[model samples]
Target chain A: MRNLDEDTITQAVLARHTGAPDARLREIMTSLVQHLHAFARDVRLTEAEWFEGIRFLTEVGHMTDDKRQEFILLSDTLGLSMLVTALNNRKPPECTESTVFGPFHVEGSPEYPLGADVANGARGEPCYVRGRVLSRDGSPVPGAELQVWQADADGFYDVQYKGEHGHRARGTLHADAEGRFHFKSIRAEAYPIPHDGPVGRMLDALGRHPWRPAHLHFMITAPGFERLITHVFRNGDQYLDSDAVFGVRRSLIADWVVHPPGPTPDGGRSEQPFYTLDFDFVLNPLAQD
Target chain B: MRNLDEDTITQAVLARHTGAPDARLREIMTSLVQHLHAFARDVRLTEAEWFEGIRFLTEVGHMTDDKRQEFILLSDTLGLSMLVTALNNRKPPECTESTVFGPFHVEGSPEYPLGADVANGARGEPCYVRGRVLSRDGSPVPGAELQVWQADADGFYDVQYKGEHGHRARGTLHADAEGRFHFKSIRAEAYPIPHDGPVGRMLDALGRHPWRPAHLHFMITAPGFERLITHVFRNGDQYLDSDAVFGVRRSLIADWVVHPPGPTPDGGRSEQPFYTLDFDFVLNPLAQD
Candidate 1:
């Protein structure tokens, strides 16, 4: 055997994978090996550092369960999740941009009608959310499903509060004949992500905070249109400019207008102050699926 | 708010870390984001593929435990460990080359005298191992510690059969006044790494195996010499050219001379056949403290 150096070792690694029957797998593995080697070289990572990484990854795995996804959190903190999202969702300017589908989402949320109160007494400032699901050509996408979820004012998802109330600040709504949908919920609040895990410790050591901007999670889907998983951030959120997960997009910011105690636009009387937010979502047509 | 495409979003992510006080953290994070984004772009990774990667990593993390280190195995298979090893251990050609410190090492091992048998009744061909510890200038390094461990001919480490014969095929010995040491052990054998976990599944999917070459692991240390972690592969082992961990180096191969059933060179009789392997290790001087 010839003495192997850095470059030849990398080449030897890549060459061994030539027999991978799947082309895509080979491509990904090749790039992954190259980039990983480069990262190690770029940092001159020491053995202790490598062992630390191993321990961190192990703890991240151990922290993961049905409710917590520390690996996704690690990826989010590292900006990998957003990078992958951007690569997959390259679209024209007219369409709504996408972001991370964070780990809090649950499938088959209860469907509600327009103006329905989905907050279920969760505490926060009262807010009215109205949105229209539109196509690229400004046409209504009636029957489009908007799966919405967000943390309560306490910054805890209903899942985190397990026994108190099931699935608070979460629901599914459909666009009407006019491609319009609305619901009532508490105003979203910026909150620190779960940082008690390994990823959290990593962020702290790196001098980065784990706060994501206040926003409502939305996964909108319609027939003949590409599904969009995104968030509607409150305009001028403190954390928007430095979202922990890097999921913020300027176009997804919603203007929340506060109102005096009076009648709501939906013809409902409110005893206390309330807020209203109106936004529109544009979905690109699915590419010949 | 403008819509975010790939480039703008990457910039935003990097910008969020500007407040990091440590310059090294900033540099590492910046390079990490760039390489990660580039890898995704190079592969044009799909959302499904991204999630698959996430799940794979999660499983790898879950498979890790006190005994099993799937992540290190993953690193080894991808040649990252060897790359880092090469980067850190660049040395003159005369100096003995280094390789990975595989996961089978045990601390506070039983110390044995020269010519003591380390393999206690393990089924394999009897072998005499003798080596010398020297400095870069060929001077003997007395009192150097030789921490030795390897799999028996049946390809099982002492740690594997934890309940049967605890701590077999492992011992630590020190160089004598002449920097010479010898030990009795079974012929080292090529062995497959643990293949029952997520890493195993990954190797299977990638059309690869988990077999390492026949070799003995050594960690030599002295007061003024840089620590040397390496392995001596049996010459002509089938897996020498394709070590599962990519840890083989030309200078680390050993020549094992076979002998007929007769009196051994160490003044011992062996009714069955036996072999002898003589090798020397050269340690580089310690770096300035």
Candidate 2:
């Protein structure tokens, strides 16, 4: 208990928390309080500005519901989501790098067999995606689980469409004995995240666009390896240089080969122009329990 | 538009606001983004911790309504409200110092005449408060508006009582030509801020008490001078050393003299024993229009 001045209040607050039951919680709270105070002092935050922040946060909270999470969107737009992902995902050079696990991934997507089309009732150019899951040593990891999802050409996920029950442009697939997996879906499209909320308003006020680069969301897991959540961005997408969520990486970007309506790279026939996108993912070993 | 790494994301976020129409808003936002990112970096904040913060903020938002504002409470407990008050109320040494104008003040309180008791329908130890509002040169400032409010002996403001109305223990008053003002109320009682919400949970987790020092709220305004929002804390209160809001200052503390049943210091006789509190407030000269 002390009459704390601006310079001493941070110390006083920290001292009060010395008896916290959890050491990690205490450490986290101390750092949080220090930074929170520093931020306020650094800017000499005004009462009016502080009130504005409170109101803005309340509005963001109110905007969140079953289909929307404005707070997560706020994190993404502020680059915190990506920064945390990078911090938690220090991997070997051969292992796939991770990105923001966006808010649209569903819990249980319908499983599909090899060469199945995931874009049911969705409209877009056909894209054939074939990938192999391997260990860091470049050996195939059979029975690896691949959970994949993406937005349609119209920039909305299957869950976003009203009255829609089935998952579109999303599916679960398994790697075979050779660790090979393939599926057909609509080409990934650069799309704006849900921008009708407070986060969208913030982006608009900042003169920033909300469009993410065209990419496929992937979460790969196998026995004796760490679960890897990553994204494979399409090459030459205009928004790649400025993905709204800052989720793109050079290694994750791959070329999409366009072929005439004929024999495909996997020996499959098609009537219209289709794309062939081939990539491989390497997983890092899981940590000891 | 660039793919940002941890080192570069702050600048990218700041650059997005170059086109803001309001210069002040732009400045505030740029500073906010920088500090926000710096805090995250300093803590090496994890995704789980970030999500916890989001959830805490969301709960705070849900707790706020027309009657409750947990965000303001959050700011007050964090010492931000007092810091901002101190920053904005820089005054000459002679002028009375200011503190936080807490959330309990109500607009259009019933005005009372000098020497009148403002504690109608409120129960507590009788206390007579006398003060003078003087200008820098020690001259009386007639008709300076003084808005005052405080909790009862039970540590509850009138607003907190269900079915209570008419602003008990609160009143508006005007200083006389001689700069004299006096009123009757109950002795200020140390009280815990509303602790049933997220802030309370945080305080409990940090092993901090939620009690504030006993005090009276005052907002003084004159036609020409800057408005002063402040508190007069009880000199010997137990919580003065550890006010939950960090709002106590040495200059604002004053002794409350107790008297047996008899003639009062102001020549007013009473059958019951009462306390007398005396103080003087010096107002800075009004800013030139």
Candidate 3:
């Protein structure tokens, strides 16, 4: 308790947490403190730098609210969110790999029947998206619920529009008995994550861009399978190799084929050039606990 | 860039920072990311736990404002502040050891002459504090400025009273020709740091107490000596061995001798019981470039 120098203070801190009733909590706090102490010691962090970190975190926190989650942005941009996703959602190679569940996701999105135009007046070239949900054994996952959302061509999600936009380019739908699902939406485009906050300043200082590759967000849930939250990135996007959040996975990329102004997947004629994408999701079964 | 598993994402993240212009910033960020990723992998951190951390940080940020800083409290309780203080203030064995510069310190305190009662309407047993500032070689450092502050009997700093109290138990003064400084204030008592925020919740979860030992804060500065920010802890305090901030050092402890109703240090009579404390500080000379 006395004379806690830099080397011994870590042990003293860990000793204080010996009484935590929750084993998991104790383990977590122990690892956190050890690594945190090691980090401070490794960097030989100075008082001024430490104060600057505190100020940066405070600014990040203040930037968070119901509409914006700057802390999650911090995590995503730092690749921590992807790392956590990778750790928590380890799946067989055959099953779909999960990625960052970005901060723009909203609950209670309107549900429509299969093949509905989920774009809802959002601007961009019309795109028809179709996918099938299957189990790891390659069987149909009938009636699986699919929650889809994406930023419009202008690179802004409906939530980022500040009440000027409705639930555009985001909706919930269900797969058919054959596990086939389709929806009409705008073409995805590479866009920067919500910058202009503390995280943005950090990225700018680091000389890193905040743009993520063009992608569509998906969250699929079935009765007996693990929930899958991932993105289907456009195959040839420029930022695909450098997705800002590190959310890109090889298995998740799909080609967005462009067609002449002709019949669309929805059996509707499009006067303007339209794009279509087809991909399949394989869900892993719930762990046998 | 693609197929980034848990093991590879760390390097990918670090590689992105290769272009940082400031070398120090880049180094700090590199260590931070490495330790952060290692901690996550060590704990096999789950998405739920990650969300909890984000939420906790957000709450801590929201609780902070111009009047209070919850993030600093978070760092202090975790012993990071103490570690940083120890790292930045590595003095010779004989020089006074530094401790956490708590958040309650305010600039522009009223200046008072030597031996003045700085406890302006604060409630506590009257105590006389006297000390001499000396160089590490034991020579007096005359005209050293001493900034002193302490919480009242109720464990509340003047600023914690929510504007109801002006300046109480805090003032700035200069040492005299012999480097001797004296002030009249209240006897220090063990008190809890401001809890009831997210940091408090974390302490409760860890089964740790938030109390710190009784001590008087002093920031001493002389012309050729390094700035000394430290505390003279009251001997025999119950929380001495379990300071919530891990700020206790054997050399910083001093005894507060109690006296019956009698003459005070300033040649005045005290009807109530009074306490007197005598301590000396040794400052290290500033390092040469």
Fraction of native contacts under 8 Å reproduced by each candidate: 0.68, 0.46, 0.88
Question: Worst 10-residue stretch by lDDT in candidate 2 chain A?
Answer: A1-10
Per-residue error for B179 in candidate 2, Å, reads: 1.6
| Ten contiguous residues minimizing lDDT sum, candidate 1 chain A | A1-10
Give the alpha carbon lDDT tens digit for every residue of A1-289 in model 1: 2467887887888888888889899999999888888888888887887887778788998999888999899888887888788888888889999999988998888888888988977778999998899999999999899999999899988888767566678999889998999999988999999999998887887778999999999999998999999998998788877788888888888888899999987898899999998889999998883
- The residue-by-residue lDDT of candidate 2 on A1-289, one tens digit each, is 4455677777876777788887877888877777677777777788788778878987887887778888899988988788788777887888888888999999999999988898986878899999899998999999899999999889889989899568899999999999999989989899999999889988887778999989999999898998899889999999988788888878899988888899876677889999989999999998887
Greater-lDDT candidate between 1 and 3? 3
Off by over 4 Å in 2: A1-3, A263-269, B1-3, B264-271
**Which pairs clash in the backbone of model 3?**
none
Q: Judged by TM-score, which candidate is best?
A: 3
Question: Could you give candidate 3's per-residue lDDT for residues B1-289 as a string of tens digits?
Answer: 9889999999999999999989999999999999999999999999999999999999999999998899999999989999999999987899989999999899999999998999999999999999899997889999999999998999989999865677999999999989999999999989999888889889999999999999999999999899999999999999999999999999999999999998887999999899999999999999898
Q: Per-residue lDDT for A1-289 in model 3, tens only?
A: 9889988999999999999999999999999999999999999999999999999999998999998999999999888999999999988999999999998899999999998999999999899998899998899999999999999989999888865666999999999999999999999999998889999999999999999999999999999899999999999999988888999999999999999997878777989899999999999999897
Tens digit per residue, CA lDDT, model 1, B196-220: 9988887787888889989999999
> Candidate 1, residue B151: CA error in Å?
0.3
TM-score of only chain B in every candidate structure: 0.96, 0.97, 0.99
Clash count of each predicted structure: 0, 0, 0
Candidate 2 residue B127 Cα shift, in angstroms, is 1.7
Go through the candidates in order and give each one's C-alpha lDDT: 0.87, 0.86, 0.94
